[model samples]
Target: MSGTILEMKGICKSFPGVKALQDVDFDLRAGEVHALVGENGAGKSTLMKILSGVYRPDAGEIRLHSKVVSITSPLVAQAHGISIIHQERRLFPALSAAENVFAGRLPRTSAGLVDWERLNRQAKEYLDLLGFQPDVRTPVGELSVANQQLVEIAKALSMNPKIIIMDEPTAPLTDSETEQLFAIIRQLKARHVAVVYISHRLDELRQICDRVTILRDGRRVGHHLVAEVSNSEIVRAMVGREIVERFPKVVAPRGPLVLRVKDLSQKKRLKNISFEIHRGEVVGLAGLVGAGRTELARCLFGVDPFDQGEIEVAGEPRRIRSIQDALKAGIALAVEDRKRQGLVLSMSVRHNVTLASLEKISRLGWLRLGAEQEIVQKQVRDLAVKTPHIDQLVGNLSGGNQQKVVLAKWLAKQFDVLILDEPTIGIDVGSRVELYELINDLAKSGVGILLISSDLPEVLGMSDRILVMREGSLVADLERGEATQELIMQYATGSVDARVERCGR
Candidate 1:
């Protein structure tokens, strides 16, 4: 048998104004974890979609196990022992976990009814294989995002496919969940399954991937064995530039406290979280996944109501009951999930950029098109947002550009304080640097910044002070000079005592 399980040669795909993929070539081997990596819109996803039959390649030849094959549809791909786990999961929320797992090919009884017992049994077996134990009969909507992702993986594994393609599988998972996933990948390797792993986290890829293929601007720029490639080299190949420093920290003089959260507590998530951010200062919220960082931001943004708290803005007590009220109170939030919470994909880039401050671009209760365009144009230039034009749909832009649009939307609105939750999630290394620069610039402009992220290095590098959260409580406050990876991880993983022993003091 041939060592290769899959291969695509000279693949080319294009959208209306963008060449998504241009003459890209890729290959996968049996029992190997091959990583596909690139900047957002660097044609990584496009090439993977073509391989999985989600998108028909404009021109290419796919060879399966040393033989040329045509993959016209997803069913055809599945028939050939191929499966793809999408970043955005497509689970049936109303159905039970077992039912969703055995959605299309459920075992049936002699009378043509689904065998519920067998269904749960099979689903439980699959979950067990991944070191997970959830009630198979329970509805999928009730499960957390990380659990839902595991269920998706279990569903894919149940097919007993020879090739499995996973995209950003660990984006929403915790550290433990990520470890579990790595274990599963090892098991798949033992079974000789060819795994294609796609992720933006270069460090994790080094830990799990055996080989890597990097694409840039729809072309396969480089491919190398993981042992021979460094993170900086991969980053340079993906972005076509050498980044001198990962974090660009430019400290501005701190001013008086612009906002203060006193005893902020939310149901089941945040417990008496108190912090303060001074004007022209970046305050970091550091924690593990599900550590109430996002919950605290949401409460402050009025997306979720807090049970008890006092919010003082510019030395005045404010009542923020909704997002509208928060905006009017000179507070802006750039949410974590850009697709779900930040941008309306169907709208044009111009529309999304000016969405928050429509009143500023309106005359006599009507939108001024020229004013809106000028604002968007300036933001696009300032942020270096790469798009065809302002009239282009936001949905068509890549993840990095979409995030820039979200930033632009908030920038258009005049605000005293800005809260950013995981602002660099899934973005490329270069784009992350740009975002850091933008944050520094904003902080220098006297905007109090609250940066919430699980990336410890990012928090330590960018913040003036870091506040650590455990479970639902604020456990430690560390100045930038005192914060280290060891100290942060000790608190984040709950290995250190949370009795407020003055760790970061």
Candidate 2:
């Protein structure tokens, strides 16, 4: 916390009928890792975009090092030593890691031709700094989500930027990878490079950030030093309320067993997996990254074929060979990556709403546009999806809005069982509450839900029973009354004491 490197004062922005930002104030200091936090559509993204030259402030002043500057484009921002790594990665899949890093500005030889050696060497150096070693020649298309995020960081660092804006950089990273990233941040701090670290993990901010700025509804709500703010205090400031008891479990009716799996295995990803989800109950699959939580979800949802397993839905064993079969069996899955597998980006809200159940809106091969609009409108209101209209493109919506659309699509299908993978990943405080209420309502209506999420608090809050996973294996099965943060963590990381005497046993 020293001299200020960048500042934005009285920033204001609007889109159509919505005021995305209003009179926001923010500043970043040299040699400091400043954190910016807010829920989706809270104006955090909009304000950062203005600072990085993606959007011009409707009314404001930007000063860099005591002198004002107008950033008209991304290139201009880069020239002024500012860069942003988006939450949704924008790397080209067809290119190699080295190529993606040096996409626009590749090294050239004397004749102005490509210099592969220099490009690979430079990319390898950055990758090494991030504790990653992969074939630079391999295309980015083959890399996992975590590895792809590292490439994004490498691209930002390649610019030798004076200020780097990281948006949810740790969303895809595992625990070890996240620690490595923190180490890299410390190295950047020593080099006097200002970093704007944006993430939903409040605890991580307390550990790494020098200062934090909270944005709500596109306005600066509060700013405080990390040492002066407690986690509960920060949550109150962000959501304007106390979030007591993060995981609030209730006694469910526990109707008939809706889903049963035995010997479920998908080659190497899943092995001998077995579980049962009952109607009017919420079963949570808790685990760290790459612990087969998502792999099991995919297997259950028909995204991946099971090498060997028997699935019994509603007490009848059946084969879920494809997504269509899963739908026919009344299984609805809000995928982990909603943008990638859950919703069609290029489609309209109305189209996506009815996508999973075209039969409901189709009459004898003739589309009923009026009937479709009515259903779409009902879901939009039911789920509180923020869109200009049903005709609005899903791609143009915010992350939370897009997620709501996916949920709406599934709700329209009237599934008996719903599998939500990270349903509230990037949503804001208010929307998270809304989702919780919806899930509770669904459970009351006898819908069996298998909730998979990385947020420990959320998993604990809404689950009737919790299952901990580690390295593709189920480590513990704890009831709601028996679960605790420490106990769940121990099982999740494989620290469970097998020698301990069981109280009931």
- Which of the numbered candidates is closest to the native, going by highest lDDT? 1
What does the lDDT come to for candidate 1?
0.84
Per-residue accuracy of model 2 over 1-505 as CA lDDT, tens digit each: 5799888999999887678889999999999999998766677777888888999988999999989999999999999999888877889998999999888999999999989999999999998888776898789988887788899999999898899999888877877888999998898899999999988788789878999998876778889998898877777777777877454455568899888877788878776777778899898888888789988888777878889989888888878987767766778788766645667778888888876444443333334566777878988887778777888888767766888888887776577889998887666665677778778888888889989988877878899888777777666777777888888898877777521122111
lDDT tens string, model 1, 332-362? Answer: 8997766556778888998888764344533
Q: How close is candidate 2 to the true structure, as a TM-score?
A: 0.91
- List of clashing residue pairs for candidate 2: 39-428, 247-460, 247-461, 248-461
Q: What is the C-alpha lDDT of each candidate?
A: 0.84, 0.81
Q: Please state the error at residue 361 of candidate 1 in Å.
A: 13
In candidate 1, position 88 carries an lDDT of: 66
The positional error of residue 399 in candidate 2, measured at the CA in angstroms, is 2.8
- CA RMSD, predictions in order: 2.9, 3.3
Q: Once superposed on the true structure, which residue ranges of model 1 sit more than 4 Å away at CA?
A: 131-134, 356-369, 381-384, 493-505
- Please give the TM-score that candidate 1 achieves against the real structure: 0.92
